[model samples]
Target: MEETEAATEKAKDLIRMGVARAALLEPQDKVEVDVVPSALIIGGGIAGMTGALNLANRGFEVTLVEKEEELGGLLRYLHRIYPTQEEASDLVKAKARKIRENGNIEVLTSAIVTQVQGFFGNYDVTVKREGKDIPFKVGVIIVATGAEEFKPVGLYGYNGVNIVTQLELEVMLKAESFTRNNVVMIQCVGARDDNRNYCSRVCCMTALNNALILKERNPKAQIFVLYRDMQTYGTLFEDIYRKAREEGIVFINYSPQRLPTLDKGFVNVFDEFLGEEISLLYDLIVLSTPMIPHPDSGELAKMLKVPIDEYGFFLEAHVKLRPLDFATDGVYLCGSAHWPSTVSESIVQAYGAASRASIPMSKRRVIAEPIASVVDEEKCIGCGLCEMICPFKAIRVEEKPGGRIASTIIASCKGCGVCGAACPQQAITMRHFKDEQLLAEVMALAEGT
Candidate 1:
């Protein structure tokens, strides 16, 4: 009886504190902003073209920009695709044709985004083309700027002639002039090392596909693949891997500590299974290098005010919840810009990004959540700390007639409470999570209410 009475008194005290705190708290207001109803896609690769077609087909205008003179990015250079063994050029051409025929889609070649301003559902983008600036408004932007193959120039004594990269090997295969009977392929050339530390994802399959092609070309050709690990993960890829082995292609696993040494006409490696060093004469050596982020990725990330990982790939908002979106609401990402991906994977991601971006434009308005950062002009000292600390650049210090003051772009604020925590003068507060409201909840829990 005594313990119950004490608990009741504690609960009563917490209820009183909660009531007082609730009285001081105020509800936040919601803002509705108009959307532009258009999108900007920054790439003309398979991913970008697919995204553009999807958006245009759905009745949304799309501006597809490419840095190169034509569309088809890296797919244009490939001779054939894996698993099904389809002609890569035909696939790229079909997609390009669809994008070109779509009236709602505007294709811009040899163009680059010079500037980006405004916020979600209302962005002002400027593109540079032929010594001119083309400015336009867009509801959202998708970055599909694909990656480039890592040039393994000096590593493993790569000479680009006999010792060529997988991409270069594709060119030789396309020309049908690769008449090397004794061929050797080295995997993970500049990847999974101390410098890169990534798998490259597609190198193993590419090497296997090319190896099978060579075997088909020359029945008695001796082809050897030296790999760290075979990543034939999917069902189709696994089937091809088995087929390569059945066709008498030799696969040898090597350790990073015992990498293959390349010479003019011979390659030496320590075979892990055989537990012995082996030297084989080769007419051609192909290095399966990784795909790295483009050189312009940094500049583009800065211009869009989005985050990129340490390796320079664009960082998405969340790994699961918002895989196609950036922390900035108006921006989306797909293809190798996010990571090294195959053509099919890039197309899937592009479609996902396009669908995600179309939501606001289709709605034609943005209803901002009530929870956001609010500024207290009286306590603000214009220190600019909040402005600098904001990842989304949601806060800015403006010069008024009286003095300088910090202001929040309500639409741009993600309600992350970053500015509130960074403010030294206690001038910023996050609505719906203010001090009084949080304290009331805390006291309520403490009293077991």
Candidate 2:
């Protein structure tokens, strides 16, 4: 009888504890906010236009802004595209035509985003056009500001005459002014070096493609390509590479230690395969450099409150899961703004960004997830520790009548819980994962319930 009483008392205690713990769990209500079905796409380049057209096709209004007076960024300067040898002008013209025809898209040229405020689902944007600041309310933003080509000026003794960049050479090719019988192209001129340790992904292919073009123009032109490594990974580019080899173009493997030296229409280099230093006389020396981030990328990133990589390219939310998105919700990235990309890759990324931006617009309302950070006013000491630790800048210390307190912007809080973990007074708590709720789970596990 005594044993039975003791066991029953223990059972009662466990039940009481479980009930008390269960009572501490407070269910949070979902916040529903009206969403604006409009998007702001920065940059009127190929990616920007493609993303705008795609969103407009989905019945969403779009605002496309360009820093330049016209559309077609780098594409406007290119003579022809690689592998297919298609005229870049034709492609840009078609995309521009579609953008102009799209009634839902409002194109803004010679405009810059002066200010950006608000959060996901609703953003207040200010554009400076002709010294006037125009306001725009948008649901999402896509950053497609393209990058600029690196100009290898002093490197390799580039003088814009004998040693010219690939872009300059493209212009000469278009004008039919490059009638040089002997030409030497140097790949990875301003890239894959100590300063820039990234391979210009397309420089090798560009050299080969342009070499083939030169061969087509003059069958007897002596063309040579000096490269560290050929990055013709794609099958189409590889096919072109093979065709270039078959067309009697010489490809020499060169090392950085023995980079080609230029002296008045002559280039000297040590060929790795031949194991000998050789000098060649050429009329033109084309330096195939990489595409770098735009000079204004930092300023743009600051305005958008987005993070950029060390190389000044906008950092995506995730490498695989959210390549088109920023960590901040409602903001997306595409094109060379993210990284140096080819035309096809830029177009694909633009469409992906458009699709992602259309999600909240399709739902017609933005639903806040219940998992968010909550503040306990009584325990808060107004130390501002939580505010300082928050990476999203979601928490702010406000001065109230009684004392200062840390307040959380629930819509901006991503439930990362860094603020809660960093709170000295333990005043900040993450919803659905409060201390009492977590302790209850621990107690349950301990009792083997």
Candidate 2 per-residue C-alpha lDDT over 47-110 given as tens digits, one digit per residue, 9 for 90 to 100: 9999999999999999999999989998898888875678988988999999889899999999
Candidate 1 displacement at residue 410 in angstroms? 1.6
Task: List candidate 2 segments past 4 Å from native.
Answer: 1-23, 376-389, 393-406, 421-427, 435-449
Structure candidate 2, residue pairs in collision: none
lDDT of 2 at 197: 85
Clash count of each predicted structure: 0, 0
The lDDT values for all models are 0.90, 0.87
Q: Judged by lDDT, which candidate is best? A: 1
lDDT of model 2, residue 150: 93
Clash count, predicted structure 2: 0
lDDT of 1 at 306: 94
